[model samples]
Target: MKNEFKGLIVQGDKKFSIKNAKTDYTGGYNKEKAKDALVNSKIEIDHLQEKLYASGTYSLLIIFQAMDAAGKDSAIEHVMSGLNPQGCQVFSFKVPTSEEYEHDFLWRHYKALPERGRIGIHNRSHYENVLVCKVHPEYILSENIPGFTDIKKINKDFWKQRYQSIRNFEEHLTANGTVILKFFLNVSKDEQKQRFLDRIEDPTKNWKFSSGDIKERALWDDYMKAYEDAINETSTADSPWHIIPADKKWFARLAISEIIEDKLKSLNIKFPVLDELEQSKLAETKNILLTE
Candidate 1:
């Protein structure tokens, strides 16, 4: 199932175009079918996560990036539903705080990385520095970077440098036992409009809508270009990007679970073996407990 979506995974300096991508793909899968698959995936993920936690051999870092109303939150909530809370950490990055701006863009992300045996999820991650900031170059001024007093001086090279930095960062993590899985939820513009309308019409979902989302929607094309470039530049064999067709939330969730399970399986994770002495100690403890 994971291989079925390899086309969705950006690779090898490919020229990516959001216009050429699909946002409602289901690969002949229906919602009911996808839900069943998701249930199985959740069960396996629960078991794999237990082994991953107990083995203490590797960590998983899942990064989600998408436009507003693209279902990043729900996807994370559902696909990670069965994970142990003790082995999972989720962080949603909004605007950079004053203290965050004090350091480099990737600093906070590095600090938030999962420890060995845990899974860390980033709702909107370090990729924002290149995506949103690229779309709105004016946002660069807020970073307080050295020698950039003039925002207009921020040139194409600035973005290139950031992309290189991101690639280096991911490679470093991969070398140190963290498996990186990046998902770009590719929701269509019309679908986004409909979702926005749903949020407006549904009183319970009112809090999810924001005027700022509308403002950002106005720059949809620019954002798409930014995503294309960023995905193309940073997606490597070690930390590849999966451009998920997110209009159909059920399919998207199922695809995400499949991809996650595939990665976990590839890690060959297993529970740690007890030494002979440890096994003897365990037997002694069991005898004592039974006698008690």
Candidate 2:
């Protein structure tokens, strides 16, 4: 697992460049290789999840962000399938309700954070403040931050402030025993178009497609710029973003699994220790069982 696919990102250097950051990773999606990686990652993550649960030392928060048809749900399902259900929870965020709109932007997100010794996965997260809100500035009006009515100033500072806020929030979580792993599934526009077309053609998947998806795709460049800015600004050491190559489903799954496995391994978690007295008691119980 260590050497199977290190630095696998095909255009990773360019995409990660500070000067001209890009969000496309279509070149690294090898279906056969990805399957092997995913298999190994599943074993590692499962073992780590058990240790994390037993030791009760830390919690994990995984965030996934992607455009429509970028396979966020499928990624979560496949990558997390091996984990103990009792030790993990998944939250899918949607458009805010009236009640949600009444509170601060992070309030609803804060409510879904994982408890001690568990993993929480967010399909979309508080990043909406910078991504979706950047695209649709009117959404900021719903946040109701004081003096935010001035569109000009709000546009200028909203995303920068939100980026700082997210950094601070994640740092606070880390200080309080949380390990956050964020992934921005980078899908190509052509792949997305193919996926949308598949959804339209298939009866079972038709429900997932909507006219709004096309409308959203029309603003593709705007969203890409917003994404790049958000990632560059908010990706700190405490809560770094893994820009996953997601043009292919299998490769996307493998990258996600690898990132998760790496995060869990970094915690150095181990199975709970039993004292000598407890070990002796367990031996005695084993003897009794043999006699019976």
Candidate 3:
């Protein structure tokens, strides 16, 4: 049934097209069915998170990337609401500061990674170096990396190196017990327009609307191309990208939750068990506590 959801996972060498992917995908899906599934998934997620926390053997890293008005914030909020805050950490990355730029692109992201028995959520993440910086290459000049004085000199090879860097970084993480789940919220341009309009019309949501978003919207095609290239380059058996349909926010949330739950389940995590000696000590401690 999960296979029926096309464009859900980007497999090997698949050249993804943002236009061909369906945003409002409700071919045979029912709202009630989705709601029920989401409810169950949330409960399972809460349970799995407890196991994950107690096992202290593996960590999960969830990465979300999308264009403006793609509902990244809402998706994280809804899907992760049930998880314990101590076990889950969320980081939203913006433009790099002078201090950040001094280090490598993935430096800050490395610092934010969750330890064993935890979940780390990257709202925007290190991919911004490839997506936003790819669209506007001039931003790279600000980094002042060695041997790149001219923005015009930064060509495809430059971005290619960045892609390789990202792939290597993710591979390293996966090799060391970090399970990576990358989600690209595939929101259509039309849906985004409606969302932007809603933000403008709703007085409370006006703060969410920014003029810069409109400017970025103009480069929708460019951004899509960048995303396509990045996903294609980085997706692997260890860490794959899921192009989630974000037109229907509910469906997106449900899908995200299911993926997360499934990944955690695959880990086969279990709480530590006490040995015979430890059990004996524990029983003695329990009897002492009862007497008290």
Best by lDDT: 1
Q: Rank the candidates by lDDT, best first.
A: 1, 3, 2
Local accuracy of candidate 2 as per-residue lDDT tens digits, 1-292: 2443344322213345322423344335467776876888899899989999999889999999999999999999899999999999999999998899899888899999999899999999999878888898887787677898767767556667788888889889999999988888888888899999999999999999999999999999889888887877776767777777667778778877887888788889888889999999999999999999
Residue ranges of candidate 1 with Cα displaced over 4 Å: none
Candidate 2 — which pairs collide? none
Clashes (N, CA, C under 3 Å) per candidate: 0, 0, 0
lDDT of the structure predicted as candidate 3: 0.90
Per TM-score, the best of the predicted structures is 1
Model 3: residues with Cα > 4 Å off, grouped in runs: none
Write model 1 residue lDDT over 246-275, tens digit each, in one string: 999999999999989888998888789999
Model 1 vs. true fold: TM: 0.97
State how far residue 233 of model 3 sits from its true place (Å).
0.7
- Pairs that collide, model 1: none
